[model samples]
Target: MSEKDQRIQTGKFGEDAACDYLIEADYKIVERNWRCRSGEIDIIADDAGRLVFIEVRTRKTGGRFGTAAESVDRRKQQQVRDTAQVYLRSIGCSAESIRFDVIAITMSRQMDSILEYKHYEGAF
Candidate 1:
C-alpha cells in the first residue's frame, strides 16, 4: 500500500480501537466522524451524564514528526470546541457538562499494531 493508504488505515484502526475502549469503559458512543462547517469530531460520546467530544489521533511509533497526542494543538482544540457548539445547537440539547477528550494511538511502523494508547480526558 501507498504511504497515504497506510496512514489512512492506521487512523481507522486507531478509531476502531478507541471506540472499543470507550465502550468497555461504559461510554455510550453517540456519533463517529461527525462533521459540520466548523470541523469534524472523531467521536461524540455520553460519559455518564456528561457529553464528551473525542479526538482520535494516530501515528506510527518513532515517527519524526511527533506523538499523536501532540498533533492536537491549540488550533485543533478551538476547532473541536466550535464544532461541539454547533452540534449542541443542532441537537437542541443543552449539556450542563461537556468534556474534550483525546485518544492517541501509536502503532509500530513495522507491524502496524498499536504500541501505545493514551487517553487524555478534559484535554483542552
Candidate 2:
C-alpha cells in the first residue's frame, strides 16, 4: 500500500482501538465519525450521563511533532465546537453538561504496538 493508504489504515485501526478502550473504561459510545459542514467528530460517547465529544489522533511517533494532542490547535478546536453544536441540535442535547475529550494514540516503531493512549477529558 502507498504511504497515504498506510496512514489511513493505521488511523482506522487506531480509532477502533480507541473506541474499544473507551468502552472498556465504561464510556457508552453514541456515534462514530459524526460530521457536519463545519467539521467532524471521531467519537461521541456518554460518560456518566454527560455528553462527551471525542477527537482521536493517532501518530506513528511523537518525537518529531511533539505529541498527537498538539495537532488539535485553535482552528481544530473551533471546528470541533461547531460540529458539537450541530450534534447537540440534532439530538436535542443540552450543552450544559457536555464535554470535549482528546484521545491521543501513539504507535511504536513497528507500528504494531500501541506506545501510549492519553485521554484528556474536558479538553476544550
Candidate 3:
C-alpha cells in the first residue's frame, strides 16, 4: 500500500482500538467521525452523563514526527474546542458537564498491531 493508505489504515486501527477501550471502560460512544464547519471530532462519548469530545491520534512507534500524544498540539486542541462548541449549539441540550479527551495509540510498524495506548481525560 501507499504511504497515505498506510497512514489511513493506522488511524482507523487506532480509532477502533480507542472505541473498544472506551466500551470496556463503560463509556457509551455517541458518535464517530463527527464533522462540522470547524473540523472533525474523532469520537463523542457519554461518560457518566458528562459529554466528552475525543481526539484520536495514531502513529507507529518511534516515528520521527513525535509521539502520538504529542501530536495533539495547541492548534489541534483549539480546533476540537471550536467544533465542540458548534456541536453543543447544534444539539441544543444542556450538559451537566463537558470535557475533552484524547486517545493516543502507537502500533508496531511491522506488525500493524497496537503496541501502546494512552487515554487523556480532560486533555484540554
Candidate 4:
C-alpha cells in the first residue's frame, strides 16, 4: 500500500476504536464522518443529552511531530466549529447544548496496537 493508503487505514482503525470507547462510555453515536463544504467531523454523538462534535487524530509515531491531540491547532478547531455550525443550522438546532471534543489515538508502529488513547472534552 502507498503511504497515503497506510495513513487512511490507520485513521479508520483509530475511528473504530474511538467509537467503541465512546459507546462503552455511554455516548450514543449519532453520526460518523459527517462532511460539508466547510469540513468534516469525525464523529457526532450525544453525551447525556449534550451534543458532542468529536475530532479523531491518529498517529503511529509521535516524536518531533507531537502527540495526536496536539496536532489539532487553532485553524483546525475553527474548521470543526464552522462545520458544526453548518450542521446545527441544517438540523435547525438552536437551543441544543454542544461541546467540542478530541479523541487522540496513538499506535505502536511495530506491534500495530494502541499505545495511548486520550479524550479531551471541550478541547477548543
Candidate 5:
C-alpha cells in the first residue's frame, strides 16, 4: 500500500480502538467520523449525560516523531472545537453540555500491536 493508505489504515485502527475503550469505560458512542467543511471529529460520545467530542491520535510507540497526544497542537484543538460547535448547533444543543477529549493510541512498530491507550479529558 502507499504511504497515505497506510496512514489512513492506521488511523482507522486507532479510531476503532478508541471506540472500544470508550464503550468499556461506560461511554455511549453517539457517532464516529463526523465531518463538515470546517473539520472532522473522530468520535462523539455521551459521557454520563455530557456530550463529549473526542479526537483520536495514533502513532508508533518509540517513534522518533512524538507521542500521539503531542500531535494535537493548538491549531488542531481550535479546529476540533470549531467542528464541535458546528455539531452542537446542528443538534440544537448548548455548548455548555459538551467537553473536549483526546484519546492517544500508541502502537508497537515491531509487532504492529497496540502498546497503550491514553485518555485525556477536557484536553482543550
Candidate 6:
C-alpha cells in the first residue's frame, strides 16, 4: 500500500477503535461522519442524557505534533461547533446541555496496537 493508503487505513482503524471505546464507556452512538456545509463531525453520541459531539484524531506517531487532542486548534473548534449546531437544528434537538469531546487515538508500530487514548470532555 502507498503511504496515503496506510494513513487512511490507520485513521479508519483508529475511528473504529474510538467508537468501540465510547460504546464500552456507555455512550449511545447516534451518528458517524456527520457532515454539514460548515464542517464534519466524526462521531455523535449521547452520554448520560448529554449530547456529545466528538472529534476523533488518530496519529501513528505523536512526536512532532504532540497528541491528537492538541491537533484540534481554534479554527477546528469553531468548525465543530458550527457542525454541531447544524446537527442540532436538523435533529430538532435543544442546544441546552450539549458538550464537545475529543477522542485521541495513538497507534503503535504494530498498527493494531493502541498506544494511548485520551478522551477530552468539553474540549471546546
Which has the greatest TM-score? 5
By the lDDT metric, which is better: model 2 or model 4?
4
Which digits, one per residue and each the tens of the lDDT, describe model 6 over residues 7-50? 78987898899899999999999999999899899999999999
Query: What's each prediction's TM-score?
Result: 0.94, 0.93, 0.95, 0.95, 0.95, 0.92
Model 3 misplaced stretches (Cα beyond 4 Å): none
Question: Candidate 4: misplaced stretches above 4 Å?
Answer: 62-64
Better of 3 and 6 by lDDT: 3
Report the C-alpha lDDT of model 1 over 14-118, residue by residue, as the tens digit: 999999999999999999999998999999999998999999999887899899999999999999999999999999977569999999998887745789999
Clashing pairs in 1: none
The lDDT of each candidate is: 0.93, 0.90, 0.91, 0.93, 0.92, 0.90
Per-residue lDDT, model 6, residue 13, is 93
Question: What number of backbone clashes does candidate 2 have, counting pairs of residues 3 or more apart or in separate chains?
Answer: 0
Q: In model 2, what is the error at residue 42, expressed in angstroms?
A: 0.2
**Of 2 and 5, the candidate ranking higher by lDDT:** 5
Q: Residue-wise lDDT of candidate 2 within 8-121, one digit each (tens)?
A: 887898899999999999999999999888888999999999989999999887457678889989999989999999999998877999999999999986688998999999
Give the runs in model 6 whose Cα sits over 4 Å from its true position: none
Query: Which residue pairs clash in candidate 5?
Result: none
| Per-prediction tally of clashes | 0, 0, 0, 0, 0, 0
Q: By summed lDDT, which 10 consecutive residues of candidate 4 come out lowest?
A: 58-67
Model 4 lDDT, full chain set: 0.93
| Order of candidate numbers by lDDT, starting with the best | 4, 1, 5, 3, 2, 6
